[model samples]
Target chain A: MNWNGIAAIWRFEMARFFRSIIQSIVSPVLSTSLYFVVFGAAIGSRIPEVEGVSYGAFIVPGLIMLTVLQQAIQNAGFGIYFPKFIGTIFEVLSAPLSAFEIVIGYVGAAAVKALLIGCIILGTSFFFVDITIQHPVWMIAFLLLTSISFALLGFILGIWARNFEQLNLVPLLVVTPLVFLGGSFYSITMLPPIWQTISMFNPVLYLVSGFRWSFFGMADVPVAASLAAILLFTALCLGVVWWMFRTGYRLKS
Target chain B: MSAIVQVNGLNKTYDGGFEALKNVSLDIREGEILALLGPNGAGKTTLISTICGITQPTSGAITVGGHDVIDDWRAARKLIGLVPQEINLEPFELVANTVRFSRGLFDRQRNDAFVDQVLKDLSLFEKKDNRIAELSGGMKRRVLIAKALAHEPRVLFLDEPTAGVDVELRRDMWALVERLRADGVTIILTTHYIEEAEAIADRVGVIRGGELLLVEDKARLMSRLGQKELRIELRDGVEALPDALAGFDLTLSDDKRSLLYTYKTGEERTGITRLLSAIQDAGLTLADLQTRESSLEDIFVGLVHTEEGEPS
Candidate 1:
């Protein structure tokens, strides 16, 4: 329903994405390339391999997940937050649009932006390291679902944040740190048994493990478990989004 | 003319228990400009917001074109366009794209011709390709109006459309409003500028402290509450009031050079004849005499001030 409205919002967001080509599309590609250079060069020399995979290749999914998760959230969070900040959100609120359609437009475009960055990083990783995909379909599936889920999370953050500081609080303070600690650079097996148990509690660990499995066919957790984690988290994010719209939490006011 | 938008017993109390509206009711006839005049904090914006579905009412109901604003919001909203008080446009978006995007949001089919016309009408066609950040303040306000009109709605709400614009743009906006009226669009605008209401509004509603004191035809309200003043300049200064004029309700100027007589215009007997006769009988020589009618501004100030329990 209201496909025109949805498309208008989506297209407007995408246009904005392209307009800021350096910040939106190029920065992630360049920064993640630096991650490859720093992590692959400095760390790969000593620890040549982990689980029979090169240290350089092993970190590819971790890097992709790290960037994808943060970008998805940041892109969407800023997407909605800026409009609300400058008061342009009233245009969308007064339009003949449902909450679901609004979410789809902003989150959908944000997820797509994150996916573009993820795919670019994947392409750029081939230059620094040797890599293979044992399950290309699963890689794509995980890429899509993870992008959408994190984008939804970002959408919620956008609405909940009242100021600019709060907008970046979660992605910078919470998500980036979790990505680093969630096995982005090294395997969890190298950790002490107690730390490994605790690391499993980190949601980002499941995403990286599952994504890594799709490439190397070796993972820290069962593929089914990772899939279940993503699905469950997605459901939770969806529930929150639905509740936000239903109550008009920060939007209606 | 049939009622295009009807609001009945509408009430809005904010989360902190501040009541912004109280049992407000109104019927907007098709193709008439209704001006809601009120001072700041008078709930004018709240009333417009509730009808546009931007703010939910705590109680009561509203319908636009016979569609309930709540249950059939999509249908109701399609017929309404709002130019809000705030001028908030995407700074980076192109001007033309802004209007097109708004049309698309209304589910309107592609109509470049219509968008083009709206831009042209708002005198923004030349700046269509420029980003909003580059446009001047007057141009930005025009962009807001163009965006509101892009979908060709049956009813349009302009909330303080000419609040801080230059005289040229204000006149341009007023001309545009008149053009829209000629095209059969029902217009509802809220403003504190009494002159604006007097100039363009077919009907005027005075609102104060979340209460609508009156809604009447502009001409009728002016005549019904309109008062006249008679100023009689004396040939010389007087130290004291004349005993012959003691029967009249009159005030002598501090210098005692003139006398001011206030009377209702609606009364058949304005007492002007008697007052003039009294002045003549008192052997007062009048140097000059003038009669002036009160403006809507006076009536508005009177209404809002009196409602606040203050002397007007």
Candidate 2:
């Protein structure tokens, strides 16, 4: 019930983000624009269209997903990790805030950061390709849900990591590859039957499919299945976070 | 004064089987200064951290202002502020914002005026707009104090607050502690500097090997265990101590120019009169006499050495 405490943490984190506003906003925008130039301009010209949507427009949601996923994990991971690294976490630990409030503050700010980057990339996509959102509300929901979920995962990573290298380990080696292989640029339907079957195991595939469905109204997986996948994934992340705080894992001895 | 902070049967055993605390019990009276004196790795920081709810106790109960530190942490924590041993600050954050942030974290309203006053009190008002990284080491320690005081808690724990600071800053900190005590804030500080405890603490506690050896009123602890030495300088040198003075608890200096007599301060009779008479009868003429009292450091060293089974 410590609303002020939660707001304090949120404001403190947002202040840090604002301090590096230029770098935070510009890096992802520039990177997403590059993907548009490389995949939308050069590759889309050869492909023409996939499932009645232009190849360039097809990758827009996927590109936003990619950027949102990476930024969310990175922002939230570094948000908590930096405090641990410098020993300032003692302040938070000693405060009159609850674990739930702490999570709400850290994860909430991180989600907001990821959503900002996602929206900016969405705006940047307008300049690169002609796009229409058939389900704008669903798109926002998907974006918000994904940001919160990934930020929670990032919070876990932050607590678990002992060093900078370990902090970057999962996001780099595990997440980026999963996003790329999960059909960020191409539809899973384009793959062979065997590959498509294997792609079902990749959780990122469902997130991208559901997010893309909100844009094109066509998805590789059924809308309900994609929705279920994302909801289940969010619950899983929440459970892990709850467990972490409950046991004081890596946070208290 | 009533006990504002109470710790009972506290124990902390880390995963590696290292016991940081063992059945530590204490009661800090409201509006008094209690100093915990110990050597390095003596559970001082760990004890503070546990009471502040930064570390979970394996088995214990700690209550601040009648609220349990674990179960009712929100209320318990509202009554406490902690200045940790490390100088940890957000390097990029402005000094004023840093203090404000701590206040907010404790669920206090945004009181810019109060925050400014705290900064001024710590002599950090001039650097309030600067980033923490821009300040010197002493200033950073001041900022830590300001942050801890920002929330205006009833109990404050200062863990080695003057470890590396210069003499002037140390004196300033002592003065600040006195001012806070006058304002009715109970304070507990941990330090290895026996002089710091001697100068400021109303009561002193000594810990070693994760065990609290004792806690008592500063003056009482000194008087109860303290020893005094009387030195009698002779007019002439001698080869050895005379038989007349041998019966007394006395030793001659290597040059035989002086005799040293040791006695407890609590003793009803120091035997000084008898010793002087014996020296006179032994045909020794006194040139001058001097007496010295043992310091807290001396008593601390003796206690620790005795605990370690070493000669004191």
Candidate 3:
């Protein structure tokens, strides 16, 4: 309810993001560009197009999703964790701000940062391949929702982690593997029937499929399922965060 | 004077069953400076944390300005500010922005003028635009004080405000605390330095083993516990104490060149007159006599040692 408190926290976090502007923006852009070179130029030349779209253009949504998800989690995770690590979290805890405001401030800033990185990658995609969005609104919608949900997950991760190794554990080990195996480079239909069935269960697949559908109007699974999956994940994360603040779990001792 | 903060039977036991605080109760008068003195792991921080609502109490209740800390935390928190033991600030953020942001966190309306004044008060105006990382340890501590004062809360909790600071900075901090007190802010500080409490606190609270042993006016505590020592020098060394001087609590020096007598300053019957008359009657000629009163440090050491020696 304290709008000023929210803005103050939001602004402070965003200022920290801008303090290391190049590192925040360039790392993702450069990695996405490399992906374009290796996957779009090198592989697309021999593999041909998938789903009637060039391999380079078809993977754009997947690449954006991959970058957004990683950045959201990484940025948000480090954001909250650093405060706890250095003990500045007391400033927030002692303030008049509620847990909801604290979340909105931190997660909100992380989502915005991820969204900005996603746009930069989206722009980078234009140089190597001709791409068009079938549904610009849905594309943005999916982009925002995905960024927010992952940022929420990152917030939880930040609180849950006790050390540096634990903080990076989920994103580096679990999320990266799921993204790679979730049809980021090729269509799920290209896989064997059994592998395709397994791929259907990968949560990242629905995120990528729905996002890709917004760009190419084609999806491996029903678009509604993708939307439902994201909504459910968001709700679950919110529920966990609410409980965290309520019980002072990990945050208060 | 009215009490600004009231705690009734506050207790805190960690998850591992370590009781950090036990049946702690206090009343902090408005506009008064109170100091909690304790050694490391004596639960000084825990008591402050519990009152500030950063840590939950296992049992008991605390109210600030008549608002319950548990049920109405938001309102209660708005009335208080805390400068924790840790020196934590966003290293990348500007000092001015840091204070401003801290104020905003309290839901206080934007008052850049007030922020500027706080920086000025703390002599942090020159470093306003500088990043916290660039500031020295002393300056960083000042920034912490500035940040706490940004919201202009009625009560301020400074936990170890002078810990790890140089003597000069510590002096400056004490002066700042005095200034804050002059401005009608109720301040509660925790420290292990007896001199700090003797210098700045109107009242002092002693805690040990998760319990408050005493809370009394600083002047009264010192005077009531103060004991005077009388050192009497003898012209000739004595192989043994004379029977006439046996009525007094006296001890001879190892060299047998002097005798020592200790008596309470507060007691009506100090026994000093009787002891001196006994010494004269014993034909023990006194070459010199010197009297000394105990300091707060002596009393503090005695208090802690006595409690530590007893059964829990």
Candidate 4:
């Protein structure tokens, strides 16, 4: 609640951000652009837009989602992860800082990193296609919501991770695939009705679909349902993180 | 004069049925540097972590500055600063920022001037802007100390702070600890280095195998339990001891160049002067004489090694 508490966390995180500024900026931008070239251009011409937009333009939100989610998750994950890795977590754990203080500090930092990546991808998407904003408010809403949600998820993952390799497992293998299956690039409508129904089960579908709706004024999922999923996921991740802090689960170990 | 930390009947058992601490109780007096000495797996770190509120005890209680460590952790933690054995810092952060961040954790006001003084005290002022990874081992250790000191906690715990460190840094660190004690900070140190405990600790607490052995003032414990030795160098080397001197409880060196005599303080004379006169009668001459008191290391080893009571 206090600015100084938040400032303490924000400063530490921002310093880490600047430490790898070149890498954090370059990796996501380059990766998302390549997604545009390969998935948008190479495959788009073969298939028409399922939702009345060019395949290139349709994929823009997904690419943006990719950068934002991964970077946000990693930003928060590494922020907490490296502390335990280098054993400096003892300093934070022993300090007068409470569990809530730690969450706010690290999560705020992650949101900033995810937001920066989202903005860069949105800015650079102009070169590949005619990216238009159908509703700026909703766009900002989904951007903030998705980034914060994933940042919380990453914060939990970082504390639970026992080693460096274990930290990579969730972000790379589990999360990236969930994004792919969540309708980031392809419409669940294009699939058979059975698979489309299953695609609805993926939580990420709502985030990407909702974000895409903000741009094109349409989506396979309803705006209301998307918003619900976003709120629910955010609440869930925050609850789990709070529990980790409260119980001192892997953080103590 | 009251206790800064009061631990009552503390016990800890791991998930696998391994008990690390059992019914341990002690009062850590304010403004005194108490050293906790033990071998590996003696539950030193476990006890310190529990007091810091990072690990929970399976049973019993601890209070720091009259606040229960579990029920009122924020206030209790605010009063205690713990330096773990590891040298972990944010590799990307500057030294000054690291210390400042620690202060802010306690919701303390920003005092750049005080932080600067702490950096200067630790000799980290010159590397204020340097990244943590850029500093050497000793500097990183100092950074941990500076971070712990930044919040100005009343109690500071150093867990094996100088383990694996060189002698020069170890001495310098002990000197700094003495200075902190002079400033009225209560210090609890755990070390495998016996000399550190003997050199700096006002009172020494030894724990072994999940049990508290004894806690006592340094000199009192030394005078009460420590044995003294009298060693005599022989002017003439002998292949074997004479039968006439066999009645004395004396040990001969392997080379037969010297004799060592040990006696309890409660015993008088130990017949040492009589033995010297008898040695001259036996035609053996004395070259030199020396005596030594038992050290803390000797007492600690003797205490822990004999607790099982099988001549181990």
DockQ winner among the candidates?
Answer: 2
Q: What does DockQ give for each predicted structure?
A: 0.78, 0.85, 0.81, 0.56
Point out where model 2 deviates above 4 Å.
B254-256, B309-312
Lowest-sum lDDT 10-residue window in model 1 chain B = B303-312
- List iRMS for all predictions: 0.9, 0.6, 0.8, 2.0
What tens digits encode model 1's per-residue C-alpha lDDT throughout A1-253?
8888988888888898899989886888899888878878886777767878888888899999988998899989999999999998888888889998999999999999999989988999889988889999999999999999999999999999999999999998999999999998888999999999999999989999999999999899999999999999999999999999888899885
Model 4: which residue pairs collide?
none
lDDT of 4 by residue, A56-174 (tens): 99888888888888988888998899888887777678666778778888998999889988998998899898878999899999999999999999998899888888788998998
lDDT of 2: 0.93
lDDT of 4 at B232: 81
**Clashing pairs counted in every model:** 0, 0, 0, 0
Query: Of the pair 1 and 4, which is ahead by lDDT?
Result: 1
Ranking of all candidate structures by their lDDT, best first: 2, 3, 1, 4
- The whole-model C-alpha lDDT of candidate 3 against the native structure comes to 0.93
lDDT of 4 at A188: 83
Candidate 1: residue A191 Cα off by (Å): 1.7
- The candidate with the higher DockQ, 1 or 3, is 3
Model 4 Cα displacement at B27 (Å)?
0.8
